[model samples]
Target: MSRLDDIIELIQTTNEVYFITAPGRVRTAYILVDDIIELSLKVFLQEKVYEQRVNCQIDLESASLVTSRNHKDSLRRYFEEKLNIDELSNELGRGTTGVPILQNHLVSFPLIRHWSANDPNARHTFDRVIDDVKPFFALPTTAPVGTPPNPATNLLDEALIRHKTRNKFYHDQNLSGLDINDEKCLSALCAMFDLVDHLFPTFSDEVKSKHTVRCQIGVLRLKQTASLGHRELSQPYEAALQLLKKGHKYDFERRSVEHSLVHTVSDRFFGSLREQFKNTIAKLQVRINKIDTMARPKQDHIDEKNDKEKLIQILQKQLDQINALLGAP
Candidate 1:
């Protein structure tokens, strides 16, 4: 299964477990949810960085630097050094030790800043949530020494509370002064879903489309055979063509299909077709030679020879078609 599949399954299973487990285990559920969220964000950011690198949007030196770090660290470095956005990078300097620091910083990072720069609503959404999210990354000491932690100031604060609660349960093996209940679990889930919705709004559709393309490619490969005759070969060829057509319908970017067709399938298919044509030509030449050797070739023999010539012509036409498809010289 793909990494995206694993992450989606993790989220779904954790949600189910949270609903069924006893209240005592709800903290564990929350921790599991947090871990899944962290994993998902890391995967998403790493893929984004990879896409940028492949597109030549990231310089070689910066790409080399980011690749050296772990995924989370790579994300932090990319945002800072590559994108020149210090939002996620600044979180690294915070004194917090055990918490997943990258995930903490993600709440306030201007993830949509570049993509939504022209849209005021997107900018406004980030501005409204920024202050609420900032406190989650603040050092514990920054809170009052004796005063009870203030009630969650916003959804971001609520997520932070769930994170801290889970951290306490992990380290202390106890949930002292913490409440683990359906409401808390639901709240954490909502905050996580919200973050996911904002950060990867198109994630589900992208996954579905990719899976469809992958399956179509698999079917094309399976339909192909070593001994495919000219007619038989068309099935797989047309299947591949259909796959490319469907992919173009969904994703207008043709680079991937073009690359696969030209670099992968075309080369192998051209070689196979050329070899088949050569073999057919050689066999036809042999039959024509035998027909010539017949001192008094019968009418039936003549007709058979004519049929062989027609077959040779048909094979030549098929070779031409193959060459056209491959854009071969």
Candidate 2:
């Protein structure tokens, strides 16, 4: 039996299940398995020895709760390699929000008072959960008592293929830049948020992630991809012509480009914009120091001459850099 079939069979043996769905570039459907079989599988998969120093920091305020220090790195791998979101979604009869929510839950657990830090015993517990269900990944098929066995299929892989098709439609069709209906453009905006939200529950708090703020700002200046078979597409249509040719790929492309560009610029400018501010402040500090020296009761007029020249030169250079950065675009 396929992994998906195993999951479905396991669920069928259970009493009830809860589900969550998320839609975006890809959809993730999650089925909540609160059974012994499900819990055991989780522990087993989590037990694999990670070759890195794992940080089990419970409090975010004390210090940064850095998790993937020596681990496989990346939340994406956690979903695909560990939980297998797509298969889980199919088992639950939901869309795609399943994987992200589980990731969020794992990361959101409170500091367990009895949890041992860096203890192998504690770590083994997680492993055991996954080990119990390792067979789910490779269960043998019984073929329903010989009706003719069907080939196994990984639902997650199928979902990924579907997601790619939708992605091309949304991004490659590139009709975003034109003066089109606000509703479609608005939907794109919502879709962007929804995509991130579905894929990563830690999406907004992505600010806390490595270089996330910079990356998010970078997303503003993206480009659009023209729809397929629109080589003859042109601009400035007549009012009547405009009404007829409503769904051009150019409109989608334009919106995508504009949104991406906005994000790119925001990330580039804001990420290190403070450094520029500090440079300006340093220049001002030189002048302030000179002024303080000049106002002193024992002001050395001889030293003031050198100080004045240095301050003037520093301020001029600072102002020049500021002007250049601002005027660039």
Best by lDDT: 1
- Per-residue lDDT of model 1, residues 1-329, tens digit only: 76766765665556545534555556766777677665554555455544544443233224332233354454434544553334433432322341354334333343422232222233323234445234433547866677565333344455555566677764775556565765556556656655554446564444334332222222222222222333544443454455445433323333344334433444443454456566766788799889989999999989989988876776666556444334455
Highest TM-score against the true fold, candidate: 1
Where model 1 places Cα greater than 4 Å from the true spot, the runs are 23-25, 57-158, 172-179, 204-329
Q: Give the TM-score of candidate 1.
A: 0.33
Write the residue-wise lDDT of candidate 2 on 1-329 in tens digits: 43333333343222111111111211111112223223323322333222111332323213322234422233224333443545534343334775564345445432221123223254434234333333434445754555532211232233233334334544775733323232222233223333323333343344323232323322211101112222111111112123333442323343343323323343343323434434544655676566667645354654665655554454344334333323322
TM-score of each: 0.33, 0.18
Q: What lDDT would each prediction earn against the true structure?
A: 0.49, 0.33
Error (Å) of candidate 1 at residue 220 is 40
lDDT of model number 2: 0.33
